[model samples]
Target: MTQLKQIKLIAFDLDGTLVDSAPDLALAINAMLVDLGRSEFSEQTIRHWVGNGAEVLIKRALSGTSVIAEDLDEALYLKAKPLFNRHYSERLCVASKLYQGVGESLAALAELNIPMAIVTNKPGLFTQPLLEQLNLARYFDVVLSGDSLARKKPDPLPLQHLVEHYQLNIDQLLMVGDSKNDIQAAKAAGCASLGLTYGYNYGEDIALSGPEFVADSLETLVELMNGSVTA
Candidate 1:
């Protein structure tokens, strides 16, 4: 594997790797459920259901647990999606917070003049507002949301788009995220991936997804990058 310093373009998964947006997501989901006259889900439940994107999260919320896409109630999902989007837009950063070392790690990477991009399963409507509200909009050179393309993570479409657009070699980029979708997408796109141990992986360990590197804190990532740069 190429060292982090050798990687020129860094693509990140927004929700778990960069910020802990689960609290805000939970609030929106609960409100949408209440509007639909359904019971609210706890943050813990919602957090595990998040990496798949808002639509899947809502489907899981409405169905009360893990659900196959084909098994979703189309009518209920159609009714609930708009409600969730509206509420999430209003509460974008109410309880969302940057994880420890995120700002520093980003800053260190920026100081190295590495171009960064964000590839998230979040839809553009919610993604833009959340990034703006959290002041994270400045760090990314490119932002690909769930709706930006026909396919999202675990499919590799988003990252492949970046590689083509930036004229980047697969080995020249590093995909950093907190879920299996991220690693799967990276591997499919032929890029190296780094997984965050503390981030949500649908109630599983991130290492099981087979990222090239795994760390519990972004500080550790910065250390790896710095060491590689100096070595």
Candidate 2:
């Protein structure tokens, strides 16, 4: 693994990175499908469709595949969106859980006085609640949801915002996630990225994303960044 360059700010991706929200998301999606008189999908299938955003997750569910059809019916999508939102809102924390070592690792980092933030593609409506429910919100001062800015990950705007807001040099920010989207965004923003092997990455290997570092557990981060996400 390449050593991280003097990280002063660490930005985490929610959903797969910190919390395993698939069970709840799958349940809500199935509820929406049932309401729409459609067939319900399994949670495992739904897991492959996560990490993008709620809108795209719905699109994938409506289309029944990760590769959403360009000709997906907008009218049906219009109806499904609110249905999903309502269904999800009702069970936001029912089946969701923070990944193993997440809470402890975060607390460890907090003790180290490392400034942190969250830059997830999940919308603020869902993102904030999930964090609060899991008690992860206290670890971050700046939380940038998908809609917080005009652009989300893979666009680099959100991560860039963290750099600007924290007044840190581009090299001082570390974007940690489980998707190519996170690694891509960090590369675009000229920062470092750490990819986790256990999170949702479209069922692909996180190593393929070519991050500066890769670890199977969030605990490794606490070890790697004893005082820094650096050498």
Candidate 3:
């Protein structure tokens, strides 16, 4: 793994990396499904469907396991979108929480005078409120939600934009996340990546995705940052 001294800017993927939001997301998704007279998916199912953003998650929920978005009926998506948004708005963070060591890690990073940003595929509507309620809003220099850009993670648009915003070289950036989208986005943006083993990865191992490092808790990252030479 690269030393933390090389990381001038650290970008985090929201849902599974910094926080565990699956429970809340599942509640809203199920509420929408029930409103549509469809069977509700389990929380485990919803967790697997997340990371691609709300639209894709809803589409996957409507289509079931491993189904492509094209398989989802457009009419159902159009109907479910509003319902899901409304439900999620109400349930945001009711059951969600920062993962172990998230607060401490964020504090440690802030103490290091490092600039950090959140690059999440979650819609801005839910993202802002969740961050605010969880008291995580102050930790980030910027927050780029899925709706903030025409494209999100796995596309590199957000990371590229952050590089421009910070006026930093891509080599000086690190992406910390829970899924392959984060790694793919980091690679495409020419940045290093760290993956979390405990976060959702479509039920697969994050290591298989080839991130520079993998750990189960943010405390490990804090340790790295503390041990690394100052940037």
Candidate 4:
């Protein structure tokens, strides 16, 4: 557990960590593909293409494989981006849902009076909508989308922004997410990270990223954080 006694603030990643957003994302991806006169892949296939923001998600969908095509047409990509956005906005909460125990877990954390925020690479437009749709918006004090800052995850700017916003040392913040981007950002920001096993991690295990703790569910996380020293 590495004895995470110094954690003062917790920053969560939106897409994978809290919500299983792949089904709706796949619908949006397939809609974009159909617009471009291409065949669509299954939700499972599209699930692996997530983790990065919508731009890369569209790029991977256009490539039709895990490895994004090197020859994707720039103009065509420009067309696909807006198409995906429109389609995603329409079905923002259609098949998307909060992962099990998210609400109760967040409430548990709140009971501890721990400050929390959301730091995600999902775009600003889609991020808040999804949270409000799932009723998860009330739990966070700060929400930073990909476009909210100069840079997003894997760059540490989002986490760094949180560290600055709360007036805490970076080490006192703990990041919780399912992707390497989250862990990488936390490591770069000199904070602790808790990796979840259930979210999209590009078909690889989140534990491979070497977070301070790897959990299969958020229920345990409440226990993990509740038992840790806050003072």
What is the clash count for each candidate, in the order shown? 0, 0, 0, 0
Q: Candidate 1: global Cα-lDDT?
A: 0.88
- Which window of 10 residues has the lowest lDDT sum in candidate 3? 222-231
Tens digits of per-residue lDDT for model 4, 15-55: 88999999999998998888889998999999999988988
TM-score of 1: 0.95
Local accuracy of candidate 2 as per-residue lDDT tens digits, 1-231? 434438898999998999999999999999999999999999999999998899999999999999999999999999999999999999999989989999999999899899999999898898888888888888999999999999999899998899999898999999999999999999999998889998788878998888988998888888888734444
lDDT of 1 by residue, 36-137 (tens): 999988899889888988878989999888765666779989999999988998889999999998988899978878889999998988887788888888
| Candidate number that wins on TM-score, 1 or 4 | 4
Quote each prediction's TM-score.
0.95, 0.96, 0.95, 0.96
The best candidate by lDDT is 2
List per-prediction Cα lDDT, in the order shown.
Answer: 0.88, 0.91, 0.89, 0.89
Candidates ranked by TM-score:
2, 4, 3, 1
Clashes of 3: 0
Tell me the lDDT of model 2 at 109: 86
Q: Each prediction's Cα RMSD?
A: 1.8, 1.6, 2.0, 2.0
Superposition error at 161 for model 1 (Å): 0.8
